[model samples]
Target: MEMNLDSVKVVGFDADDTLWVNETYFRETEERFAELLESFETKNKIDQELFKVEMQNLDLYGYGVKGFILSMIECALQLSNHTISNDTLQEILDVGKKMIAHPVELLSGVEEVLQKLENKYRLIVLTKGDLLDQERKLEKSGLSKYFHHVEVLSEKKEENYQNLLEHLEIDVNEFLMVGNSLKSDVIPILNIGAKAVHVPFHTTWAHELVSKEKEKSTNGYLKLESIKDILDYLKH
Candidate 1:
């Protein structure tokens, strides 16, 4: 479907994966988590069960490292029938601490893209995660100056985007969302009559993966190779 940028005024960006390294850390942590539980279950089984736990806890813990750590702890206890060692539990907590402490690594040309668009349009961050953790990353990113607003959403859905636009007083057709997840970032905005740009990251969470059929049916979005390409698309 063709997208018209002529009406666009406000640009929203997704935090993890889209602007910086995020999902890769989760994948790495899952590997470590699987290893921690290897004695009770195979690596593959542990991985599957962990995913199940995360999905089940989405409402309770929401998203981010804290929720992931809790899910890992719960999975470990279940896999071991409540016999998992305290040391292993501590190790699981350490895994989350390490992830939380990791420095924010911005994607290539992220700052440049933000700089290019900063003055031309109102820019904001529309991301879902632990509020404190998302705020910490934004502070560390040093790109906070580029955004007029930063919203840490509990979830990303059509209604969430609609409310955000209303809160910001932006017309649906005049807002463009840029992010890496088709499920969270692209599809919802498209469904709400807003434009979206899909800047894909190499590593995606299993939960965010949409079926090929679902992807094919989505419209009113553009797919670009990198965040930097957004400058070319929107700067004309």
Candidate 2:
């Protein structure tokens, strides 16, 4: 674990899993959704079809409800042969939207750590999703008060991070990105010469999974089993 508190001033977090439980709710909703499609298509087929559309919608719709809605729409039309009624589609849409307003709970020690770090570090939240949904979740979580800035990103690419670093007036290496999802939060930032601390979540999201690990990174990349481990890393 490589960390130097002096080298970092702005600590940006990848919301969702880092600050609160996000994937568990998404998983529960997806399980029920998968059940709904079982009669129309096999689980394997349904997953395959949905993933195909999600790949295309990544840029067009982005993450959160918009992407989930597009995925469900594509899934319904594919499974139902373009015959699925609007009512059923609406139900899925409702579910996707509802996910945002769902009660957001912090993983154990998240509030404590944030409270401890906020006084010393300029903490900000960097999340990719529907802006409104992200804000609502942050507000509902009661953790919004602690952050100095909140960036709701459309995508988590190398450029998005580079732009953020420039806009925030900070060097890539000066910012420490703490979050889950190696593909989104770790890899791209590392590409830009930034330091990233990966806090692995217990329940990872389906879309967030990179499904592969590539070559080793030259940038400092530290991985932790849980968010609480962050305290130890920061203390040193």
Best by the TM-score measure: 1
Q: Estimate each model's TM-score.
A: 0.97, 0.90
Off by over 4 Å in 1: none
Write model 2 residue lDDT over 1-236, tens digit each, in one string: 66654677778998888888887887777776777777788887777777788877877888886677778878788889988878788888888878766888888888888988888888999998889889888988899899999999888999999998899898776788988888899989888988888888888766677644452433468888777777876642
Question: Which residue pairs does candidate 1 place in steric collision?
Answer: none
Cα misplacement distance, residue 164 of candidate 2 (Å) = 1.2
lDDT digits (tens) for residues 51-150 of candidate 1 = 9999999999999999999999999999999999999999999999999999999999999888889889999999999999999999999989999999
Q: Residue 58 deviation, candidate 2, in Å?
A: 1.8
